[model samples]
Target chain A: MIELYLFLFIMLIAAVIATEIKDLLAAVISLGAVGFSVAIMFILVQAPDLAIVQIVVEILTIVIFVAVVFRTTHIDETIGKRFASTHILSMVLFSLFAFLFLAAVVQSLRELPRFGYATMRVASEYIRLGLSECGGANIVADVILDFRALDTLGEATVLFTSVIGVLALMRKIGRKR
Target chain B: MRGMSLVVKVVTNIVVGFIFIYGVYIILHGHLTPGGGFAGGVIIAGALVLRILAFGVEPVSEKRAEERASAFESLGALLFIGIAFAGLIIGGAFFLNFLPQGTPLRLLSGGIIPLCNIAIGIKVGAGLFTIFLALAAIKYVMED
Candidate 1:
């Protein structure tokens, strides 16, 4: 639909602007806009759960971005670079890559199974046996916490390790004399 | 870093409690609702970050808060692992449904899922707040 395409177009523009902007805060804001459009696209495609996750994650990302931007005055020195032959070449290459990426994404979207089409073999089983077998009314919760719990465990470990890394890095290196 | 405007601080004071409750609600109802642990954790972290933003780094007592966050985050991760290992002990498999599953749609119906959600909520919330504190304009934060 036109609305879907419109959202995609906005996302594309936001991506471009996010990179092109000189101010770090402006760039972060534009990237947040990109996240917003993607969340809307998720909603339009009948994935409300994904949409909720996307928006919440996006908000947190923006918060982090703002924190970094405000804490660090100068993010980079690349804004000084002006129009040049390399810049022109990079722009052309980026455009070609973006075109190819969009083409592949569109093709994959078209190939995806239709809504309510029951594509996966285990999909029906989950719908039928999830409540009885897993004893959870929400099939999604059952799938995550029961069926794919090991994966969740690994994810938790990863988060824990990353937090540890952050804590370690935040501590001052070397002892005071 | 200094705190924001008085209005922002006042609004944050009122809204933060509501945000914390909402985040807990999301985690508790995750088994029945669309959201789950990670999403709820992020919401909880958002609430804490809001307070940090309004009050700034000084009143937050950066070092102590960071330590608490790290501790809570590890506790959550350990709790999740303990649940899985407990399942292995009783059910002879990792992450088995060890608890007595009650009727569907009830709070106690999800066996170990609710506990897992709560653990994830704690881990994620604490972890994210730690990250925010690290990047925040604290004493260690590089000032221009």
Candidate 2:
């Protein structure tokens, strides 16, 4: 429990500093720190599976960000262009929005079905009959590939499209080809 | 990303094979474990990325890798759609579980589940590698 709070506090600090930091590299690394903390939070919530996926995906995302940052010419020009006077106003606006979003999220979390409880009928049904009907020991595998297959197919299609897009963009004919 | 030190290259070479095998294990055992195609595929891509990081793009042939990854990505997507269409042909519903569902706890028992995992694994692995490779290649070229 204490560890969970520690992770949350680290994430909060990372978020604020990552945004406030002027250095792009530092900001990117701080954002990754937040991702790591969130992964830890997932583990604390008894979602090891999610934690695995989150950590791997987060690592890849950070790699992509680092690659982009290094590849680009104007590393600091992005945030440097913003007026100094507007920074104060934007910070105040950001704080207000962040607080509102946090309140809304907390309210939604309160409305969620209790964790470890079997109140969700469809989910309970999946757990109870998944092995018998789906003929698989892993209920998650059964649900994604058997019960919710169309969604997976859509996801695959999107991945395929993105790959194609990247290849096209990287064509040797032109830089943005 | 200009090919890390010699020690890093040696370590990456030694470890990447194990990571690739582990990813395959996770993908194949999706029916009996927590990890499935996406997690396993990402892990596999991570292994390749590790190699790229240690070896750099010039030696790795970013162009060649992108072409192969693109081909495999297309193949994986086609294979996935082909399987789904096969199900529709056999079972009269798209994405239907057409194969016989065998006993539980076995690798080959999940009908189309394992097959889907394999397809997803290939699609995701190749796709992610391609994306990273493309970005790295562009960055490398622009810098040069």
Candidate 3:
């Protein structure tokens, strides 16, 4: 519990640093830190599947972001050095919105079941019959591949479509020479 | 982007094979392990990305390599759909377990799951590598 809070605190600080920093590369690194903190929190909640995916995705995204930054500029040119009245007003409004968002999150968190107490409604069946029915040792794998396989198929289709879209958009030559 | 320093190239050469094998292990052992196709595929793509970043591009063949990756990606998607179609024909349901489900905790336990994982692994690895290759216009190598 305390460790969770510590991670949340680290995440919050890193997110703020990511937003506030002027160096684009440093900000991207800070964002990576925030992602790692979230991955840690996912592990603490006993969701190794989510943690593995999150950690790998985080690393790949950070790599992409760094690549982009290296190709572009290092400094953030949009933010001005001098503060203005509109800046102060926007900052105040942003703080208020953040406070409201935090309140809503806290309320939702309070409504959730206590830690280590998973209320398995449909998962109860998966636990009881997953191995015998699907013949897979990993229940998560069985659920994704056997029980809800259509969903996986749909996801694969979506990925395929996106790849096609990328390929179509980035073609170098349209006609043969 | 030319090849990195000698030290980086040597290290990458030593480590990339392990990463690729580990990714395949994760995909093959999806039913008995924590990782599956998507995770394994991403890891493999990461290995490819690492290799490209370390060794840089061979000036003339990157387009051909990218085309090969695109072909693999399409082939994977086609294979996945083909498997699902096979299930529909045999079991009267899409994505059904048409093959015999071996004993639990075994490598070949899940009937169609491992097959699906392989298809997805190929699709995701090839798709991501294709995207990286397409997006990064690293045409000019750094003249030393």
Candidate 4:
């Protein structure tokens, strides 16, 4: 529990650093730190699958971000330059929004069941019969690949579509002679 | 992008193969382990990205690699859909577990699940690598 809190703290600090930093590359690295902290939090919460995916995806994202940064300007020119009235107004509005978001989060947190006591209807059945039906030791795999295969298929289609979109955009407009 | 230092290249040459194999292992044993298609596929893509970043290649060869990645991506998607169509045509249901479900906890078990994992693994790995290559190959107009 304490370890989880520590990770959460690390994530929050890294997130703030990621947003507040001036150097684009440093900011990207900070964001990677934030992501790694979140991955650690996932592991602490006993979700190794989520942790593995989060770690790998985070690494790829950081790599992509760094590549983009390498091809562009390194320093952000706009940040910390001036504090205009509009900036102050936006900050005020952001704080208000943050307060409201916190209130909503608190309400939702209150509604959630106590830790380690989550109740389930469909999940229980999946746990009991997933092996016999799907013949897999990993129930999560069985659920996703067998019972919810349509969802997986839809996700694959979505990925494929995005890849096509990227290819189209890059080949047509992203290159100039 | 230019190649990194020789140390980086050497390390990548040593590590990339292991990473690719590990991704395949994850995908193959998904039904018996925690990671499945999506995570394993992402890992494989990461390995490719690492290799490309460490050892930059000629633009011409990179273009060829990008085209190959695109083809592989399409092939994976086609294979997944073909599997579903096969299940429909033979079993009269979409994504039916038509294959024999062997004993649980074994590699050969989980009739259609492992197959789906492999298909998804291929699709995701190839797709992500294609995206990265496309992004990297983009010509920056401002460079002029």
**Predicted candidate 3 versus true structure: per-residue lDDT over A1-177, tens digit per residue:** 899999999988999888878899999999999999888998898777778778888898898889889888999976666488888899899999999999999999998987666686777888888888888888888899889988988999898888888878766656232
The per-model lDDT (C-alpha) reads 0.85, 0.85, 0.86, 0.89
Residue range B63-101, candidate 1, lDDT tens digits = 678879888988999899999999999989999999988
How big is the positional error of residue B87 in model 2, measured in Å on the Cα after superposition?
1.2
Off by over 4 Å in 2: A1-3, A67-83, A174-177, B140-144
Model 4 per-residue lDDT tens digits across residues B46-73: 9999999999876778778989999998
The regions of model 4 sitting more than 4 angstroms off are A173-177, B140-144
TM-score of chain A of each: 0.78, 0.78, 0.84, 0.91
- Model 1 CA deviation exceeding 4 Å by range: A73-77, A80-82, A96-111, A115-118, A175-177, B137-144
| Candidate 3 segments whose C-alpha is farther than 4 A from its true place | A174-177, B138-144
Give the DockQ (C-alpha) for candidate 4: 0.80
Using lDDT, give the best candidate's number: 4
Predictions: Cα RMSD each: 2.8, 2.8, 3.1, 2.0
- Grade the docking of candidate 1: medium
Error of 2 at B53 (Å): 2.0
Least accurate 10 contiguous residues by lDDT in model 2 chain B: B135-144
- DockQ rank, highest first? 4, 2, 1, 3
Better of 2 and 3 by DockQ: 2
How far does residue A16 in candidate 1 sit from its true spot (Å)?
Answer: 1.3
In candidate 2 the C-alpha lDDT for residue A125 amounts to 85
